[model samples]
Target: MEWKLLATVFASVFIAEMADKTQLVTMLFAADRDVSRWTVFLGAAAALVLTSAIGVAAGAVLSEVINPRIMSLLAGSGFIVIGAWVLWQAIHGGA
Candidate 1:
């Protein structure tokens, strides 16, 4: 196993997830008096693992069809476009 790759992915995902909707939803579940924190943790972990598996599978397929450089460019541009759209919406009061 590549420890460096593992740490990089872990840190990137951990930092991104810190303030994401998943964390918020998990927090809400944990706050509910009747809900079991262990159950919430298990459910959240399972969901994340499943989603990650899908991403890995998709990437595996995509890599066979597309060059990595082009993929990176597309991914970066997609993020930029998304960010611009969000900013526009914010400026326009989401109208």
Candidate 2:
């Protein structure tokens, strides 16, 4: 196991997930008086695990055909585009 890689991924994902929509949604679900907190936790955990699995599988496949550097560039550009779009929408009162 690549300990360093594992730690890096854990840190990155942990920081990114904190206070994000997924966490907020999970909190809302747990807040419902009828819902068991364990149930909410399990559901949220399963969803995150499934999505992470998909991401790992996709990355594995893509790394075979696409250069990592190019992928990084593309991801950076995508984030920039998304950030700009969100800023534009916010400035426009989210129409």
Candidate 3:
């Protein structure tokens, strides 16, 4: 395996996940639950793994059907939209 490629993927995924909605969902579920912390953590980790698998499969399929540049553009645009929505909610105070 190429170490450089692995490192780049690790860094990109880490950055993308750090501020993503999955973290928010994990926090919300953990806080609202009466279960043990370890139980919640394990459950959340399992769910994250499953979701990541689905994302990887989707990305693989997309790569086969679309150009890499277009796929990157779409992904970047989606992130931008989510970021803008989050910012708007912060500014307006959601109901």
Q: Pick the candidate with the highest TM-score.
A: 1
By summed lDDT, the worst window of 10 consecutive residues in model 2 runs over 86-95
Total clashing residue pairs per candidate? 0, 0, 0
Local lDDT at 37 for model 2:
98
By TM-score, how accurate is candidate 2? 0.87
- Cα RMSD to the true fold for all candidates: 1.4, 1.6, 3.5
**Residue range 1-95, candidate 2, lDDT tens digits:** 99999999999999999999999999999999998999999999999999999999999999999998999999999999999999999999994
The residue ranges of model 3 lying beyond 4 angstroms of the native Cα positions read: 19-21, 28-34, 81-95
Per-residue CA lDDT of model 1 for 9-91, tens digit only, reads 99989998998999999999999999889999999999999999999999999999999899999999999999999999999
**What's the TM-score of each model vs. the native?**
0.91, 0.87, 0.64
The residue ranges of model 1 lying beyond 4 angstroms of the native Cα positions read: none
Q: How far is candidate 2 from the true structure (C-alpha RMSD, Å)?
A: 1.6
TM-score of 3: 0.64
Top candidate on lDDT is: 2
Better of 2 and 3 by TM-score: 2
* TM-score for candidate 1, residues paired by index: 0.91
